[model samples]
Target: MKKTFGLLNEEEQELLNQLVEGMTKEQLLWTSGYLAGKSEKDKKTIKKERPDMPNIQVLYGTHSGNSEVISEKLLQSAKNNGLDMKISLMEKFEYRNTPLLQNLIIIVSTHGEGEPPSNAMGFLDFLRDKDTPEMPGLHFAVLGLGDSTYANFSQAGVDFHKALKKLKAQPIMPVRKCDAEFMPEAQKWMDQIINHFSGTSVVLRPEKADIPAGGPVLNGVANAGFTVPSFKRVYDRNNPFYARILKKKLLNGDGSDKEVYHFELSIRDSGFTYQPGDTLSIVGDNPPSLVEAILDKFSFGRDEEVVLDKQMFTLYHALRNYLEITVINPVILDRYNRFAGSKELTDLINDPVQLADYLYGSDVLDLLTDFPAKLNAQELVSVLRKLPPRKYSIASSFDAHPGEAHITVAAVRFEKKERIREGAISTFVVDRVKEGDRIPVFVQNKKKFKMPEDKSIPIIMIGPGTGIAPFRAFIQQRKHDGIKKGTWLFFGDQHEKTDFLYGDEWNKLKAEGYLQKLDLAFSRDQDEKIYVQHRLLQKSEKVWKWLQKGASIYVCGDKKKMATDVHLALLDIVRNEGKMDINTAKQYLNSLASDNRYQKDVY
Candidate 1:
């Protein structure tokens, strides 16, 4: 920690310490950003003459495109308000040196465990460098976007805020944070910006001050000062449409050891359309049995009233429909351990390696069953995070089935502590959801993962198991579009007869000459187990030739092993077939990635 006395006056230091006491690093970052804006507004409000027209430089760091959406909205709002401003994505921002701007606004989202989004890595490195430029004249505001479930929520924003503060950048306002339901909060912050520039004092909205946790009551009478955002065309994540399931059939034959399913949902008249590279997001709820078990552990009744955000719900309803209970991260665990006062958990939390191991396998149920805590209904609800939605690659093309959407799912069932433990969504679909049942869903665009515009260009797809979902859509769309481009697919699974997903479709496509190559690597079919990576090595010369002829590559599947192995295989192919060294081959693949000719959609 910095020396409080040297940095600020006694009064200011006391306020800072009080605001940050018990806050996580991510929360502190949000506080810093919020303070920057408030401080700048206070400092400039007393000035007799206002500065010249604001030329704002807005920067966005995003994962899954949320931050970019927020940035664009702000940019459009600035234009509408007659403000001169420009926005740049963090990856595209010139990162060779630190940028010095007079007025800036940063909208960044953190992903994983407090790491910057993929696009912001290089830009963050530049800011962290010792030789970064000072910003004495710069006035800035920060707004962090992130999920509260993860341990390092909004961590990237915190890093940037701290770095800029060290360089002497003055804050225009304090760092503000918003959860997934960010539009209302974002709109309020935008209004504050407009008022600040107009030399108007910020108004303390009533709802911001008075609304309780959970959410406002269903009637929405208590949320007086907040304006709920609306959409024009169709449903989205905020308002998903219930699409009925037309079919749910297992792709793997009997006795296959794997249980992969192919589902077709009827989107007829819902206005929900999807592209080949898009994803279908489904919001899942906690299992009632699990929720009841936790309630039993706490000795809490189902009828107990619990509040969240400003809305009220019964303890049972909230646990089943809203809160996440499957995973326990560091932040949530710390709070639980504190409540339980368990020295063992406290010791484990202090050690980084052991804490990670515990978090990996331990869910809320595990935590409670092992070291029970005696938190009230309200306190228990407060410690847990809202359940986030699950995303799956859409396996059907709208061109072929305009009124339907398809997805492939692999059921995750395992034995834990002599009891069956199933994945939240995977098992929910397999066991509970019926053929005629309706599921809430929304489509997410994957523009970069789409097909090439030039129909004649050859394409190579490496999708093993459920990763083949999107590739099925691509090939279907190609057949529908009558594109005669050479398509090569490398698919692998356990056994040839049982695990070959979309087997009939590939055969039909090949017969029609739409597919030029179909390579299969069924590991258990022969003595030695083989995978797609090994198959790629066997076809090294052919793979290199396709790349030489301007073939684009797509990889979709497991990131841990398959993605890494396929990437290595590409490097090896480039080295041996192209007669280049390992480093040169690596650079060549990187160039393809930079140009968006190579794309990935792995989970």
Candidate 2:
């Protein structure tokens, strides 16, 4: 058949045969449609019939899937406007084809610190390298997504834009950087690009605020909020399911320095189903004390009407439920300074180090106290960002406990500037919420941190402190599947007696021979502090063997310290045990990451 067709090679023919051998009729139909779409896209790329309507493509890099979502929206908008557009992952784009592209739209999110998302690293490296040729013909636009709290806000997108400019690519529009409340801005950016490609002028409407039934609005326009449809209903950040708490228990002992709680929520009949690696996003209100303090400090009327998402809400309710108040970021600081006109605050905003120092452990009340702005309720509310949902690693598997979701939360309490402060959501869950109370909730699927589908593959999990949340779900999932012979876990905390979360469960699993290897590191149990990284180093030989046998490694925990330490330890292990040099070992680890054998879900 290969010779008769004069097309596919022997290996390709064999692969195609194997692929189609077990495919159902529906699968075959879907595959045919996908191929046809690809063929049409290829034809458009090669045959440019119109000079004005250049072939356009979208490339995205995402950590939380937001970039991909925006890219999809752009693709749909282009299609609606009778334009041909192909969308791809940044990692999948070949650098060699850079000069061939006509128009490129990049939607990317910055990952930890200032780094590009994992998928964008390769493409970013290619762009930064000296060997890469210039692409004078490429016209592009970039949209960046990030939290303004980070020092390097929208840094990945900034880097891409800068690199493309250095390579002499013409830009269709200046890069747009959006904060967590990115929907309205993202929609506008998409509309601009669609209009540009369709040769249509943008229509500007008059600014007029009106309440909408869907949600609130700000600045005389809807927030462009939308809902995702589920089995029976739609839900999203704008419209979330109110899940009743089934149970809540403090996991820490009396003498423990930390306060950790395990919560189980009933999602029964809510049309929410999640896998082990998914996250549960909780919409929590600001602490009443903090809200009252802010109102008192500003002497603002609680009953004053304020606009949010185009809907009018009482200032009290807006501060309590709809806006962020407990934390401060550069974006908020900049906005507030506009009202306060504080020169000192302006200086701090311009200095990254000073800004970081000021932002740490600070809240809205702190901002008000320091600046002493004479702003009204509406002005104050306008300065604050929307209340983003707090997402936690799901701690229980749906297979193990149907119609329920579980999460582990560690209360964040600290003393700063001679004032006691706490995390908004953590404190809300621990202090304000009671069992049977319905909390607004949604599920965020983490595609990058999923377990390998091949259950027989050996797996090593390294999670310490609250990072152990998803690992618990992984174990529960393995137990439910009744295939847990090749599992290894390294967990640590401050002390084994008080802070060893789920100690009894681990012991039971160990005794039952389901948990093949269990390593514990209690940082304060000994003279010197030891973490999961130390444990990983101690088991270097076995770890190397597991890696050789194709084991997947999962790390979940604090990104600033634990995740960094564990990553370095893994590199050292590969260098020492694999008998390779530093660069080669680094490459080996990169290969593992590329294959999805190494995954991290750190905050």
Candidate topping lDDT: 2
Per-residue alpha-carbon lDDT of candidate 1 for residues 200-274, written as tens digits (9 for 90 to 100):
433322223221222322122222334323334356666665667789999998779988999998877777777
Residue 346 CA displacement from its true place in model 2, Å: 2.4
Candidate 2 accuracy as lDDT: 0.83
Which tens-of-lDDT digit does each residue in 380-467 have in candidate 2? 8889998777889999999999999999999988988887887878987888777866667878777678889999998999999998
List the candidates' TM-scores in order. 0.78, 0.86
Q: What are the RMSD figures for all models against the true structure?
A: 15.1, 9.1
Candidate 2 differs from the real structure by a C-alpha RMSD in angstroms, to one decimal, of 9.1
Clashes of each: 23, 8
- What overall lDDT goes with each candidate model? 0.76, 0.83
Q: What value does the lDDT take at residue 262 in candidate 2?
A: 95
What is the Cα-based TM-score of model 1?
A: 0.78
Question: CA shift at 335, candidate 2, in angstroms?
Answer: 1.7
